[model samples]
Target: MKRYICFIALLAGMVACKKDTVRKGNDPYRETVVPAIYINKDGISPTRARVGEEVMISGKGFEKNKDKLAILFNGVKAAIISLTDTTVRVKVPAQAATGNVAAQVDQQYFFGPFFRVTGVFEMDTLYPSLVGANGAINNIIPVEDGKYLVVGDFTDYGNSGKKDKLNRVARINHDGTVDGTFGPDAKNGTNSTVASAVALPQSVNGYQYLVAGSFNNYEGVSYVNSVALLNNNGSLAANRIQSPNGKDITVSALKGGVSGSVNNMHVQPNDGKILLTGNFRFYVQPNFNLKTVGTDLDSVHLDSIQVNGLIRLMPDGGIDSTYNYDLAKHMGKEGANGFIYRSLLLPDGKLLIAGSFTKYNGQAVNRLARLNADGSLDASFMPGAGADQAIGNMERQPDGKIILTGSFNMYGGVKVPHIVRINENGTIDPGFNAGEGTDGFINNVGIMPGGQIILSGVFTQFNKLQRNNMIVLNADGSVHATYNSFGGFSAVGDNGANGNVNTVSRVIPQAGEKSLLVVGSFTKFDFRTANRIVRITYP
Candidate 1:
C-alpha cells in the first residue's frame, strides 16, 4: 500500500509540472524573468541593418518556443525568417527605428546590440561618430576649403573619453573632425555664448571672423561685451594702434561692445563696416574727455550713448558715425519696440530687418521693416500689417523675392502659416502658396538654385504631410513628396508632452554638393543619434 501511494504521488507531481508548462506558454504578459532587465551575454550580428533586411540574433532560449518567440527592433516587431536553438534570423520592419534589438520569450526580453537604420537622408557615418556638442550649436559659417566655423553656448565637443574643450567656438573639417590647429591658443574659446557670426572677406592673413553674442571676453581679452573679431586661429584680433601709455595694448573689442546681447552680425559689402542688431540700450566707448584734467592724467572713462539696438562699427573697432550716429533723432529713443532678430544686406544698400518688434522708430512696421542705407525706416517699402509674431529668419531668392519665416500664422492679415514670400516693395507675393504651411515655427530656410526650398525648425508636418523637423518644398510651396517620403529627421517627444524641445536651427546647402550641413539642438535624425549637428544628403 505504501509503494502504490508513492507511485501516485510521483504521477501527480509530473501532471503539475506539465500544467505549469502549458500555462506559461499561453500567458503572453506573464514573465518568468523580469522585463527590461537585460543580461548582456548575447548580441545581434551585423550590428546595423536597414529596414526589411534580415539580421541574425544570437542568444540562448530563442529556440525554446520558436513559434511563441517575438522579435523586435526598437519596439517595432520584426518577422522571424528562421530560428534555431541558439540563433534567430528576423527581418527588420519598415517602421523599425535605430535602437536595440530585443527577443521576447514568455514575456521576458533579452536585449541585443544597438542597431542603426540606414537609407536615404540618414546621418553620414563617415562623419565623426562621436556624440556631438554638449549644448546647442546656434550658428555655422562656411570657411575656406570645405571647413566651417561653429559657435554656440557649448564648452565641450565630442563623446566621453574623447572630447575637446572648445568653449563657444570651433572649426570643423568637411568630415566633421575638430580642427585642432585652428584654435590651439584659445583654451577657452569665449567667456560666454556666441549667438551670431559672419566671415569677413579673406584678407592677406587668412579669414577674420566677426562674432557677437552675450560674451564679455574671448580668452583673457576683456570688455568685448557682445561683439569681437577673431583671427583665423581663433584668437581675439587686436588693432595696430598703441595705447596712450606707449605699451602695445591689444584691443580687439569695441570700447564696451554695445551694452547687451547681439543677435545678428553682418559685414557690409565693399566696406568692412560691421552691422549689428539686438536688444541693447546703448553703445559704450572710451571717453577721452579732458585727457590731462588740469594736472593728474585722467583715468579712461567709458561713455555710453542711448542708441537702442542698432549700430555699425568700422573695421578698426571704432563706431561708424557715418551710418547711424543720429539714429535716435530719426527713430526716437526706442529705436525698435522689441529685439531685431536678423538683418539681411541687399545689393542696393537697403536692409531688411525682421524681429519681434511691432514698431520701428515709432512707425507701425509690425515685425518686418526695410531700412534705408542711412538707417532710417523706409516708409515706401510698406508691409501692411506685417507679421503678427516674430520673424526669425529671411532668405532672398534669385528673382529678388524675400522669403520670411517666423512664428506668425498670418502675414499682412492673410493666413499664411509660418512662412511667406514678399515682393521687393514688401507687398505679399501670392505666387508662393504654402497651403496650410508648417504646423510649427520655422527657424531658417535654404533656397536651392533649382528653386527648391529646404526648411528646418520645430515642426513635424508640412501641408499636413509627416515631414518631421525638416522638409524640402517645391518652389510653389508643395511638399516634395519623393524627397520626403522615405526618410527625415525625428525628435524625442514629437507631438507629445515635450513641445518643440528639439529643433533644427539651421540648414545650409553645400556650395556645389547635394549634401546639407545641418545644425541645431536636435538629438536625433532618421531615428539615429545625430546629436546637435548632422550632414544628410538626399537622393
Candidate 2:
C-alpha cells in the first residue's frame, strides 16, 4: 500500500513539472503585440494635394515592415515612398479622388479624414488666342457676380482653334469665355488701347465701368483721349463723362511724350470719389467751344484746371479740390521725376502711396509715403530711407500690415531683398523676414484666402529657394515647402527670340475660393503647355 501511494505522489509531481516547463518555454509577455495600426491625428501635412504630390500620413504603431503596410487614397492604392514605425510618406495616386485616406497594415486597417485632391488649376480650358506671343494680360478684376474684366495688350481670345477679336479690353464669363453681351460685335469694341478698367461701386447714370487707356474713341465718339464710362451693356455710356479740364486725362511717357493712359485708379468706399494716379502734367482742353459743345459734354466743365500726376474727382467727373496733394511739388528732382505705381486706402481714412520717389512734399521721403485724410503728409508715419528701388506693388494684410514688393534690395537700412512688411506705424516688422527675397523684379503680390501670399514676376528664385517666376509664402514670411509644383518659367527660343520672355504680369485671387487667376507672358507652367492666363488651385 505504501509503494502504491509513493507512485501516485510521483505522478502528481511529474504533472506539475510539465506545467512549469510549458510556462518557461512560452512567456505570455513575449507574444508579438501587433501595434494598433493607425494614422496620426493630423492626417496629412497638405490637406489639399494633387496627384504625383507627396503627402505624409502619421499615426501610432506603423511598423517598419513596408511589405506588410499599404496606403490607400480614397480607396485607390497609392505608391508608398517611405515607411517607418510612426510615419508613412506616399505619393498621391492618379486615380485618387476626394475622399478619406486609409492604411492597411497586414489585416489591420486605419482611416483618416477626407483628403481633398484638388485640380492643379481652376480653369480647365486655356485661352491661347487671348494673348499674342508678345502680348500679355495686364490686369484681371473679379466682378461681383462671378464674372471677370480682363484688360491688356491682347487682340483676341477663345480657343486656339476658333479665335475671336477682343480688342484690349473684354469681359469674360466665369467659364473663361468672352461675354458677347459686353462690347459691340466682340471684334472692334474699343478703338485703341485700354490700360486699366474699374467697376464703380455706385453706378453713374446706369454706367458702371470706367475704362482708361490710350484709346481716343469708343463706339465712334471723338475727343475721348484717355477716359470713358461704359454702360451696363459694355457700350459707351450715353451720358458723356468729361475730365476736370474738359480734356481727357492724358498719359505721357515719363521721359516726355504725350500718350493718354492711366496706370491705376482707386474708388473710395464711403463716398464713391475716384482717385486717379499716373504720369500726367497739366490738365488742358485743347479745343474748347461752348456753342459747338455736344450734349454729352454740355454739363461737364473744368472747375479746377491745374492738376499734376494725381487727382481726385467726383462721381459726375467734377474735380474734388477739397483734398489736394501737390504731386509736382513733392516729386523728386527735375530730370528723374517720381511716379506713383500703387496706392492703398486704409480703414482709418489714411492713404499709403508707393512708387519711385525719393521725397514727398519736400520731406525727403523714400519710395513710400503716407498721407492723412486731408491729403497732408502724415508726420507720424515715416519709412526712413524707404526702399532702394521702386515699389512695384503693395498689398494690405487683414491685420493692417502692409506688404511691399519691387526691385528693391533693401528697406530703410536693413537688407530686405525684394519684399518687406511694414507695421501700421510705417516701421519695419523685423519678425517678417524674407531671406534673400526674389532675385528678380516682383510685379504683382496677391493674398490667398488662407493668408498665404502669392507673388509673381521675373524672379527665378525666392528666399534662397529655387522657385521659378512665381512663389507662395506663409503668413509668417516663410516659403511654403509643399507648394512647389510650378516648374518655373523659361523662354521658348534662344534668348527669347520667340517674343515670349517668361513674365508674370498679374495674379488675382478669387474670393471665396482656393484659386488664382495667373496672367503672364509664359506659354507653359509646371512643364505643361499653358497660355498667358491660367487659374491655379491651392490645396
Candidate 3:
C-alpha cells in the first residue's frame, strides 16, 4: 500500500514538471530584450523631407558609441550628423525614398513612422493647376499630334475662368489645357454618359471616332442610339441633303444601334468592324419616314432583335450580317445568361473574352473563353474550371501567353491569388508564379516592352510585400525592386481621411514606353494631390 502511494506522488510530480516546462517555453521575456534603439510611434519629425535635407529623430536607448548606432531611411542608410541617448540628427540619404524609417543599434532595431520622399517620381506640377473635371475621368485615349481625348461623366473641367461646360467628352492638349476646337458646350454634347470611345482606323473612316454608352442623343439629335460615329470635330457623323425649297438639311444616317450600354469598344485592326461587349440584350433598329420630316426621324416606330452581350458592327454602325450571332447567343439558358466585361482581339482574328460567365455556346467555360473568327466557341483552348471569380482585365504577352487580373483566389482549381498567367492552350503556366498573389483586387494590368508588368487597383500589398495600390512585376511574376523607390498610391489617413482613397481603373503605357498614364478615382498618389489622373515618368 505504501509503494502504491509513492508511485502516485511520483507521477503527479512528473506531470507538474511537464506543465512547468511549457510555461517557461512561452515566456515572453525569454528571447526578448528591450529593443536597444527605442523609437516612439511618431519619432520622425517633419514626416516629409527632400534628399540632402536634415531631419531629427527622437528615441530612447540609442547606442552610446556613435559607431554602433545607425539610421535607415526606408532601408537606405543615412548619415548621422550627431547622436545622443535621446535624440539623433541625420541627413536624408540621396537614395532615401518614401517608406518607414528605422534605427539600428547593434543587432536590435526599432521602427518609426512613414516618411514621404519628395522630388522623385512626383506629380507633374505643370499639369493644369485648376481643379480637373468635376467628376471621374473614365478613359484617356492618346490621339494625333500629342493630344488626348478624355471621356467621362464630368460636367465641368477646370475653374470658372478656364472651365468648359462639357458633357462627358473633351480634348486636352499636351500641356493639359482644354482644346476649344473639339466641340460645342454642354448644351450640344451627348445627352447622357459616354462610357467608351475608340478611334476608328483610317481604313474604316478617316480620323473619326466610335463612341458608345447609354446616351440616346448626340448634339441634340435623337436618332443616335447607344452608339454613334463622331467626326474629327466631335460632331455626330451625318449626311446633308437638299430639300425641295433648296435649303440644306442634315440627317443622322446611323439607323440601327444597340439598346443597352456598351462598356468597352474595340476597332478591329484587320477589318474596320467594331467589336462591343457589355450588359446589353438587344440591337435596336429604327425605321425613319423621310417623307414626314426631312431633317429628323419618326421616333415612334422601331425594331429590335435579341443579342447576348456581344456584337459586331460595320463601319456604318450597322450590324454585321456575315458574323454568326446564333452561336454566340447560346449561353446556357434562354433568359438567364452570362455577360462579358472585356474582350481582346488576337492577331489571328480570334477573340479572347473574360467576365462572370459560366458557359459559352452550351459548353461549360467557367469565366474565360476563346471564340473563332465567326463567333463560335474554340474547343481547342480549354481552361478546365477557369477562374473562380470575375476576371476584370487581361493583357496578351509578346510570346502568346496571357496575364489576367481580378478578384479571384483560384484558377482552374489551383491557388493563384488575384493574378495568373495562362498559355495559348488555356493551361496555367508553371514557370510564372505570383508566389502568394496580391492581398487585394487588381483591376488593370499593362505589359511593358521588356515584359515587365504594371498592376493597379485597391491593393496595399502584393505577395506579402508592402506595395500600395500600384506595383510593377517582373516577367516571371516577382515584384520589381526598382519600382519600390517610386512610392505607390494610397489614401492620406488611417481610415482614408478626406475621401482620398485610391483606386486605379486603368494604366496605359505612353508611346515611348518611358512613362505610364494612370487614370482612376484617386485624389492622391505618393502623398501628393494628383486629382484622378497622373503621368508617372521613368528616367
Please name the candidate that would achieve the greatest lDDT relative to the true structure: 1
User: Pairing residues by index, what is the TM-score of model 1?
Assistant: 0.73
Question: lDDT values of the candidates?
Answer: 0.75, 0.67, 0.74
Candidate 1: give the clashing pairs.
Answer: none
Worst 10 residues of 2 by lDDT: 250-259
Q: Which pairs clash inside model 2?
A: 39-59, 40-58, 40-59, 251-260, 251-261
- Give the distance in Å from residue 227's predicted Cα in candidate 3 to where it truly belongs: 1.8
| Whole-model alpha-carbon lDDT for candidate 2 | 0.67
The root-mean-square deviation over C-alpha atoms between each candidate and the true structure, in angstroms, is 11.1, 20.7, 9.2
Q: What is the lDDT of residue 151 in candidate 1?
A: 88
**lDDT, candidate 3, at 259:** 79
Scored against the true structure, residue 154 in model 2 reaches a CA lDDT of: 68
The per-residue C-alpha lDDT of model 3 at residue 57 equals 88
- Assess every candidate by TM-score: 0.73, 0.67, 0.78
Error of 3 at 195 (Å): 2.9
lDDT of 3 by residue, 1-539 (tens): 99999999999999999999987786675685655667777888888888889988887766464678888886678998887788889998865668888877778777888888775345566676236666667778888778877777666555323233777777777777778777764344677777788876554456877778888877777657788887787777887756444556565666678878887888888777887778788777765433345544323456776767887788677787555465455321232148787788888888888988888766788789998887778889978789999888898999999998887788988988889999998899988887887777787888877688888877656776566677777899987655555567753444767442336666666776476677666667676676667777664
Q: Which portions of model 1 show Cα errors greater than 4 Å? A: 1-119, 158-164, 239-249, 253-256, 287-300, 327-334, 485-499
